[model samples]
Target: MFLPTTIEEVKKLGWKELDVILVTGDAYVDHPSFGVALIGHYLVSKGFKVGIIAQPDWKSEKDITRLGRPKLFFGISAGNVDSMVSNYTASMKKRKIDEYSSGGIAGKRPDRAVIVYSNLVRRFFPDVPIVIGGLESSLRRFVHYDWWSDRIRKSILVDAKADLLVYGMGEKTVLEIAQILSRTRDIEKCKTIRGVVWWSSKKPIDCHELPSFDEICLDKTKYAESTRLQTILTDPFKNIVLCQRQDSRYIIQNPPQLPLEQEEIDNLYLLPFERKTHPFYEKIGYVPALDMIQFSITCVRGCFGSCSFCALTQHQTTHVVSRSVDSILEEVRILTKHPDFHGIITDVGGPTANMYGSSCFVRETKGQCEKFCLHPKSCVNAKTNHERYLELLDKVRTINGIKHVFVSSGIRHDLVLNDPHGDLFIKKLIDFTPGQLKLAPEHSHPKVLALMRKPSVELFLEFKEKFEKYAKNSGKQRYVVGYFIVAHPGEGKRENEHLRKFIEEKLNYHPQQIQIFTPSPGTVSTAMYYSEIDPFTKEKVFVERSLKLRNAAKANLMSLNSAR
Candidate 1:
């Protein structure tokens, strides 16, 4: 990159000018991921100038050219999980569509966007640098085992053309990068960031000794090549590898964080976070911000459910943790002060809807937690606490200017049933939710629920019945909808027929809000599709997901015989 020849001569830097620029594919408004507004607040608290370029029309050749360069690093993204099925022709069309047809791939190629931005700055001013972070950069850290494409793809570092690829939990990584830059350290020279996948000093760095997440699953058949997959590819793991292109084929990789102590995870998120949650922007056709900010917060990290088809515990590491209630309530008090803020607090709780102050970490050791917390099945030592959640809810509900406090996030049936307080939590949720009650009973079959590490449909229904009765006796019939997945590779016609009958018999032929399993990367179910094996029981499963059945299920859900 050419050194900026004119920055010294033409510009005087101000705090705002020196601020970091966050450009993301996801709408920055209240986004749960980047929580750009929130992150921006933290940066400002740390005294870094920050700006956001949300969902840019990168289809234009000049998209980055016009932004010029940031005196600080540029944060780039294209929404949470960059691999979106672009064209909106039909829900089923995501499969039939390719990049040419899928507008999702049309945006600025990461490498090109980063390189051009850096280069353009070099041309005019020359010495400025650009760094890329976000899902697009994180997921691209390795020559990934792409089960869908059936091959390892190039690292995103090579594609996005950024100096480095910031992977995994970026909160600490991004800050350290700025410190290095502030010390005039050549970014390319800084190779030790915990989550960095970078070019190793003129040579491709190699990590022969690094751990592989491929081992996380106890089952080997995920590689069987028979199972159809949808949605996610592997459970979240710290195993990441980076190729060094500067010289020889050197590489860098990292093992996932040792299961974090509960206190560590809690303290990590509790750090004086400046509230950056977005105020809703009433823009039409614009990407909606993640809606990260809420009247209340829950589950800072850790979920130990560890289902073969899930990554909730994998991604965050299943050691359920939470932030201090004092910090969270403080944000509500501050947000309520805004005259425009609704007297009715919007967004009460989540990150699994109600997993606050959970997780059993060993003060004695990082001791990977035992599963079945609050379960009669096994974990006699499980650390279960629904009162913590209830306490948080009560505090938020009682906060002044807050009227209706709801659990806007989908419910975790496992956790809900574990604590009687969970039942109370749901009761309060129903009584308070002015909008909708969302729950995910992902499938109807007992076997499928077991495979997904979720509760059985019967169990979900039992809970639903209880909630319904509570609401009815009290004279409230707001809706509590279940999210179901169809066409999962393991689900075949016969299994689906059974599912339909089950729904019809139990749910009165009511169709659900159907979601065709679109196996995404970074998920356990995705691996099963790639290999067609149940990592747990060594059982073989189907590999293909049924779009037709899925569509029919959805069509059935939205219609009522009375409406017809």
Candidate 2:
């Protein structure tokens, strides 16, 4: 509850002058925040005058008047709305989980339960229109099994139970809602807008489909071996299928993917972003003095790299489209001119750095490649032109006062090693520059890597060896860093032992740079974790977060690399 300075002061501020108020259910993630701010900023941009109530605990009505109770419309999120399964559970799918948990941060009021927050708001602001969106609610738009809680849960619809649910991208929908409400359209009139999920009498209705999109029907007969810009842009799956409804309901079924338009590409670069600096900076109390920043430009929209243990293909689909070098240069110039410009660029790359303005087949396809080459061991376009990326790097390096631009973005090494100029391209980096090249080998054992559908351990080793010899030859000493996951559903202590031995026998993995595996949402690994199958070995396995074992395992990678 937000306390007004005093009852007299609160009363003096004149409690009821505003037309509408917006409430959100997130405790700011401090800096380098996520999409929550995007909606808020957009609302502000439209001139609706909004107020933010940071992480209000749902149990109390005492704090509802913190802003003096003007007619309000609330926005809520399920706190990054992720689905997590316990590493220890019976049948993995036998858990029923809902409610926000404050992410276990103290002083962080338990605003973890979005349902509770909305219900409380109803009790206090009964006539208020509460709209819910964000990952949790969006993903939970329909009934589905809550693996953590093990039961069929209703759409986040009946639960946090707001007036309406805004699923999918909130940009256009939110914009329309703002316009209507700002012009004094009845709250009921909002039901007319497309893209909004609303409650009519009792059932949920996904109103209209303004712009339809095509879905890449995964079934081979329906799906092409390769996807293209127009095919995806005109996707037919405008409705998003809520949890487990028989037919596609609530979901856009088929909504448009961002098309590869020159202007849209340029627009993406203009959006605001904050760096995701490490947490330890705060622990050491050095946040204020730190100058690190994270810069990102989307290289492409979809990924067709179907590692059965993956979801990029399912969620984002696979179509490669990119921004022009000229557009990218403009953004870089903007960053460099910022008042805090420090000649050092800590990170510059995309979803995969080696894949800029590239498709599986180039010359033959006229750059309009349909499939990122589903054929062989190499990327869709390995033998084609590699000059574009090299040129991009050179242009970036020449930026006014840049000291050293680091490619912290992970690189798809398979693409790097196969490109005609692959080895030489990297050679140029060693010949002139600073930074580590990120390779996500994921796992080492051939069986395990095969399970991951990622490059083989042998492939990674070959790449590393070349990188090492290149470094030695050029007299450059920065290292080739690798990121691997452990305790996966298929990775038993024995399999993990193989990983340990492989690291020792091969490219020494390092501790400082290793990422402990956490089954993040929307990844295929999560399915395996949910099913309790290692997939490759088909053996029952546990996705363990062995802190002590992980520490030791990471030390093995670091010490071995240091010695070499």
lDDT (Cα, tens digit) per residue for candidate 1, span 1-564: 010112331143333244466665444444233444445544554656556555445445344444455665766554454444232212434333223111322342332233333344345444555566555455445433344344444555665555665655555667667777767657764466655655554433443322122422333453332122111221123233333232244335343334344454444444444233223223233232323243344445545555554534334445454667776676567667755456655555545656566555451134443333432232544455666766777788788887766666555666677665666766766766664566777777766766676666767787777777778877888666677776665776666666666666676335546666655444557656665676435687776544466566555544544453
Q: Please write out the lDDT profile of model 2 over residues 1-564, one tens digit for every residue.
A: 121222453455454344334444434322222345455545544545444455565557655556554444666655443423222123233233222222333333342245766787778877777777665565454433354453334556667767666655565566667677667745677765655555433223533322111222222111121121122232223323211222333332223223346565455445544332223223423222123334434444444455544434433344455667887778788768656567766555555666666655342233323333331265545443456877777787798977766665566777777776788876765633454666778887765665566777777788888887889886778567667766555666677778777766665544455544545333445445544553333555455545466556555555665676
Which segments of candidate 1 are over 4 A away from where they belong? 1-16, 30-33, 57-62, 83-130, 145-152, 199-251, 255-302, 307-314, 362-378, 420-429, 535-538, 545-564
Alpha-carbon error at 6 in model 1, in Å?
Answer: 19
Q: What is the C-alpha lDDT of each candidate?
A: 0.51, 0.51
Best by TM-score: 1
lDDT for position 112 in model 2: 28
lDDT of candidate model 2 versus the reference: 0.51
Tell me each candidate's TM-score. Answer: 0.75, 0.67
Of candidate 2, the 10-residue stretch with the lowest lDDT total is 220-229
